[model samples]
Target: MATKPKSPHQEQPKTAPPADEGRFRDDTDVAVDAIHQRIVGREQTEPEEGFEPPPVWVWAASVVLLFVMGFYLGRYSGSWSTVAHEVESPAAAAAGPVKRTVNGTVVFTGVCQTCHQADGNGVAGQYPPLAGSEWVTRDAATPIRIVLYGLEGPITVKQTAFNNKMTPFHDKLTDDEIAAVVTHIRSSWRNSASAVTAEEVADLRAKYGVRGSWSAAELSAERSAR
Candidate 1:
């Protein structure tokens, strides 16, 4: 078969040119490079961690709290030498010792009651009676001497003989105590005599020094001499 020639005005069917593989590859590489650069640049310009000072209010509050604690401790804490529970006030320590009155009845009850009996009516034949006894009411010095140096050998009290020995109270009792006891005995029961003084007992104690028990004859001799 023979082919007819086309008209000059009629256009030939258009066809795409063959792809350039090298050029496409180069364009893909260029796009990837652009994306990578964008990511790297963003990372490089990003903000970094840094130290920041605390707020002014926080520092102020810490200082205020420390001052409050120090003030509280100073106000409440006692001196270093003082104990917590046994803390004594300065006023109490400055005061002098308390004055106490010595009771004669209490002294007699504790010391003399055991041997002399509470009624002053001593044991018959064993202890001499203080009730209406001539020896006790004779003179202040006689009884004082008997009490201070004690009595030995036989002695007549109320016309009755007492052979028992009497213990000395010079070392055991103070001058005031001895005086008070002697006064108590002299005024008690059926006896009525003058009250003994601490000065009298003290003088006798000083004069006699320390001696053994005195006998009735010796006591009589001394009384006669006096």
Candidate 2:
């Protein structure tokens, strides 16, 4: 059937029904209350989605990578060597035990240097000077005895008199420790003298048997006349 066309002046009858006020109202333009306003910008999206698990190819690649890494680490790790991470170092493997050496400088710095001073010139008037002192270079036995038993009462060092009491290290220090320290003090600070042997110190220590500390004169019992 032939239908007449509508004139442009006649507005088309509402094709879409007037937008429903409830459904089509602009929610963004709505004035939210204070309580809801806090969550206005932070609104939780509905039906939150999750990421997919890795594909089979990704799993396969990871397995291959881990296997290769494991093989590489097993070969190059050097876990079988004597020390950790000691690789193909032939010099390290062929090396023999090193001769144990005690640094006498270390011993002197730790113990005697406190009183004797780093320069071996002991505190004047308070402690006797070991540097170029007549008592230090007199003999091996004199120093060994002095250190083992300790010295007490007026002793002249470098022509200066010191009357302090030195604490005995006989009970505390080992034979090697005493020997190292004695040898160190003898040679240090230009105070040149023969090294005191540990064997000599041990002999004297065995003979002494917990006697009173030595007086400057009593050191002469074993001290070589110098």
Candidate 3:
């Protein structure tokens, strides 16, 4: 069939759609939905925080600190009674009384050794010697009186005269301490004498009460009277 010829400038009609347009739209929608699903899943299933235990070293350090504090308080807290809140223990009561004995040599070395010297030899014309002194070894009561009251003025010892003051130990020493030192001097340095007792010192102290230093003549009179 012969037909009229078309013009050269005639436009063609649209028929089939553009290639891969539907497929590209579907793929873009699927990619967007997958990303949204991933974000929402992460938000819904998030993990919760929980409590955790302290480190081993921290616990160990705490225990050590408590122990050190306890030990320090126990060691430097004065008496056990104070630590026990002033409560007395039955064990201590059952232990009975404690007796204390003074050492004469210790007392002499501490108190008398400076004046009489370690060897009992006195300074010449100053302090009198205690070694082999008739005033010390002859009579027990004389030394006791001398120690309790003290001696002054001129005194003869070992045939030598000394004009000096002997300080009294009545206030400085106890009866037991005075007795011990006197007994030590009597027995030491080749002199054999009887021991002086605390009872004797106490008796003399009670009899005489308190007095001044004694002179040699007074001591001699006292001995003669005795």
Most accurate candidate by lDDT: 3
lDDT of each: 0.77, 0.76, 0.84
**Looking at model 3, how many pairs of residues clash?**
0
Candidate 2 lDDT tens digits, 1-226: 2444343233222223355645653555444432343444333224333444658999999999999999999987777677755345677567855546677888788778889898877776788888898888977888888888888998777778789899888987888888888998888878789898789899999988898789988886566443
Which pairs clash in the backbone of model 3? none
> Candidate 3 regions off by >4 Å?
1-95
TM-score of every model versus the real structure: 0.57, 0.57, 0.60
Off by over 4 Å in 2: 1-99, 224-226
Candidate 1 residues 1-226, lDDT tens each? 2344343333333233356544444788667655655544313323434345678999999999999999998887765546555756787778866455556677778877776789988898988887677777778888888888899889887788889888888898888888878888888897898888889999999999999999999888878888
What is the Å distance of residue 17 in model 2 from its true position?
66
* Cα RMSDs, all models: 27.3, 14.7, 23.0
Clashes of each: 0, 0, 0
Better model by lDDT: candidate 1 vs candidate 3:
3
- What global local distance difference test value does model 2 have? 0.76
* TM match of model 3 to true structure: 0.60
